[model samples]
Target: MPKPFKIPQSVLVVIYTPAWDVLLIRRTEADPSAPAFWQSVTGSKDTLDEPWEQTAAREVLEETGLDCTPGSALAPHLHDWGLENIYNIYPRWRHRYARGVTHNLERVFGVQVPDGSVVTLNPREHTDYQWLPYDAAADACFSPSNAEAILQLPHYAKQRLGTAA
Candidate 1:
């Protein structure tokens, strides 16, 4: 009963408002003494088979306290951009994964919130949060994958709302 290794699958959710204001959070640290890094809402799945969309919703709520209820007045406009990336896990953080697990498969999803939506941060998981313009948010991301994902937001926003983002 000693198995608690993490599943090497994750969701990278880009939470944005209709106006293209992307939410980015700075990680507290991989370790207490490590430097924090900026990323969108990301979390590994509870198990390998968990549906990617559910993981995305859970991570967003857990990290930011923002509810992404489906079909509500303030419902999250969730979209799957048909994007996924598989990358080697960073060595420093490998301890969280099972032995010899070297790569992570990340599915990208977007959530659209209304203007003036509330943001509540989980202080232990993230140090700070910002609602930045798409380009600026892309630039602030620490991981190349994260940056690339944010760069796609403008296009996704236009497609979703049929208007300027």
Candidate 2:
């Protein structure tokens, strides 16, 4: 089947806990022998027809098996940092975009849930998942852009928690 014009736009939702720990999913590497790598729940906008918030919620449900409305209150903590990061799309996923498109614009969001909430993950996209301290989560990511966004979580958490910044 012919691919649709690559939509370089996307959203990156960092599901986390009150303690600044974020969820990480291990993606299967291209090399069959290579070990999987970690990442957040990220995906491109669905055909530019769906709203970005819809895309975020749909991805969350599809990747983690949680039914989340576009702006549902999973917890009291919710944040839109208005942070955008651009980076080269991984070679394996580059095919999803238009030809010659290298970088993708990722909008950042944070959704906090109870510390040990169980998650149901889609096996095809991720092999395993973990909730790690923000710093550790950042280090675990394969993409520098994702790491930088993870590092910014504390500030957003504070704002959402109403803690003294």
Candidate 3:
């Protein structure tokens, strides 16, 4: 039996520190011809009806081995940025979705982890991770949407800490 087609709806969680250092993970692509690039935690929902927050938490844990669930220590730091991005799925990856599914709707989120928090990348999905200032991280992202999201981190961080002017 073939696997079910993936849902085009997903979450992009920007894990960061209070000081504005953003975490960027290098994805491990199946095709060597496809260059690997840095991005925040991202994944599609397991079921069509899964809540966006739930998907965010799951992706965080799966990609970085961090617990962002409701009762976990990181839970209080998890935040929904109330932003969304719609973009065309790369032609090389559109095969994971159903036929004719060329676009994806991504919900944005942010999670603040301690400055020194250790990140363990999932070998299958990511090969490495790094912490960089928001501006630099944004420049490192290959996806325009992802880069834009990183560029918005300072504003989101300020808002989260009640420091937004």
Per-model C-alpha RMSD: 2.4, 2.2, 1.4
Query: TM-score of each candidate?
Result: 0.89, 0.86, 0.95
Residue pair clashes in candidate 3: none
- Give the lDDT of residue 140 in candidate 2: 88
Ranking by TM-score: 3, 1, 2
Model 1 earns a TM-score of 0.89
Off by over 4 Å in 1: 1-3, 30-36, 71-76, 162-165
- Model 3, 137-165: lDDT tens digits are 99988789999999998888889778963
Q: Between prediction 1 and prediction 3, which has the larger TM-score?
A: 3
Q: Is candidate 1 or candidate 2 better by TM-score?
A: 1
lDDT of 3: 0.92
As a whole number from 0 to 100, the lDDT of residue 4 in candidate 3 is 92
Whole-model lDDT, candidate 1?
0.85
